[model samples]
Target: MNTTPSYRTIAGDGLWSNNLGLVQLLGLCPLLAVSGTAINGLGLGLATLLVLLGANLCVSLIRHWIRPEIRIPVFVLIIASFVTAVELLMSAYFHQLFLILGIFIPLIVTNCGILGRAEAFASKQPPLPAAADALAVGGGFLLVLVVLGGLRELLAQGTLFSQAHLMFGDWGRGLSVTLLEDYRGYLLAALPPGAFIGLGLLLALKNLIDQRRAAVAKAAPALTTQQANTP
Candidate 1:
């Protein structure tokens, strides 16, 4: 049995075909909660990415030694350890963002996406592929967070990257983009319902694109055969 998955397959799984945030719908708690703005999402996303990368690498390196009966606990420990390190790092550096994220920072340990990758991919694959998988998965998650956060912030506050200082210091304060001038924002977009509605719309958009791609793929062979026969 080939225990290792190819880097391409890993990329496909993480980025598009089976994204942690979009496809698998994992980690929605923090995804929906703290993603009220782009800065908040970026901060949490980076923290999660850091934890996933570390946990995946560590699990791959030590996978052979862990007994199957205790693998779950071992995985949890590995993930929790990395999550703690990330939380402390954020607190030490980006104190404002850290305070905003609060318990969700520590709660990355409970994100099934990180643990799932460790157990499913990292545990079976070599370190290189494991790392690739982590990057791909983390990248997909980061993209979703940024997009969703941007959307919500734009709708709620007529601005993008609001409070960028929380993540990027004072210089980042200038990164905020104003879309609407002298206009009040939608109240719902400032609430949890906005996250749900935005997520649902995003999911529908992805599904629509997927369906179109599937239709094109399904017709290609038939069209090819018909052309050959006519010729």
Candidate 2:
């Protein structure tokens, strides 16, 4: 009755092969909206991950108790509970980040990646695997957000971790790196339109990398067999 996925499989699916932003293409709204800076993306990503982690654990524990007919609703309610907790925490500690991210923080409740996992993986798997899956998936999502945020911030303003204090308070202000002191910022890269452009370019880069890896994998077996036959 154990439906736990292997660690490799879980990691691959959650981090790369089935990522929410890059692969599955879920949660695009916040993925593109709040990622104007590294801290913004990191904050939201952490929130989403926290909610996913708690939701998956809760769903796995109650999976058998809920009737099949109302399972979806039950799963949603569970996710909402976690989202509420996450929202409150953010509002309390990272009040500045909470204001900047605004509605996106609360909207984590509607992200399909969360609900999809609850129904597909967590509901069927044991608690340990479910938690692992959530971690992998959330890590992947957070990574993409961070990378995207970094890309935009660096390209637009020639800085890294700009406005990090919003998340880390006074100490975080010191972490902001000024890569280009006099660099004129790129207007497009600082706007919402820029997120789409950056994301598209990132997708192209990922696809190129994937294609090269696939080709290499495909050629390896053929080359080995040919060498063996020749000998």
Candidate 3:
């Protein structure tokens, strides 16, 4: 069996090769639901990042003591505890935003991304590296959420940071940045169907780019071979 990978490998895997949002496609329910606005997405994404980091750290620290038969349950328990803490903190501090998040906030316990990281990476690595990996994965997931949220918000409302004060302080109330005054909001872009459609288009665009890159790589080899034969 291989030992723990280097930090560079962990970062690359979490950010790209094994991205929780884009590559692995884990945790779609909340990812789709709470990403309607940038602030909503940012709140949930930050909460998830905390939970992931906490869960991974706990799992890594205790992996050796836990038996194979009971490991999953232990991991779940650890993750659930973190989720509960996050929920309570949100309710106490950001009550309005917490209410808006509702069931999705508690549902973080069931996110496959958290459990998958626990079993796949944390279970096999040390606490420090596992924590780093969680941060990387969580950051990548947050990036996707924020971008998707911004896209939906811009298309649907023609404004960014419309509700910044909900999560931030009173000073943030003035941070609402309007993109267009004459803009007519796209109702479809603010709905559930719009989230799905936007995500699909984003995925398609990523695939198209990958395909184009591959085609260029293939052509480069063929061109080199033809030039070598000509000379």
Query: Model 2 off-target regions past 4 Å?
Result: none
Model 2 residue 79 CA deviation in Å: 0.9
TM-score quality measure for candidate 2: 0.97
The sequence of per-residue lDDT tens digits that candidate 1 reaches over residues 1-231 is: 656777888898898899998899999999999989988889988999999999999999998899999999999999999988898899899998899999999999999999999888889888899899999999999989989999999999999987988888889989878889986998898799999999998899889999999999999999999999995
| RMSD list, candidates in order | 1.1, 1.1, 2.0
- TM-scores, in order shown? 0.97, 0.97, 0.92
Clashing pairs in 1: none
Q: For candidate 2, lDDT tens digit of each residue in 1-231?
A: 755679999999999888889989999999999899888899999999999999999999988898999999999999999999999999999998999999999899999999999999999998989999999999999999999999999989999998989888899889999999899999898899999998999889889989999999999999999999995
The parts of candidate 3 lying over 4 Å away from their true place are 216-231
Per-residue lDDT tens digits for candidate 3, residues 26-143, read 9999999989998999999999999999999999999889999999899999999999999999999999999998999999999999999999989999899999999999988888
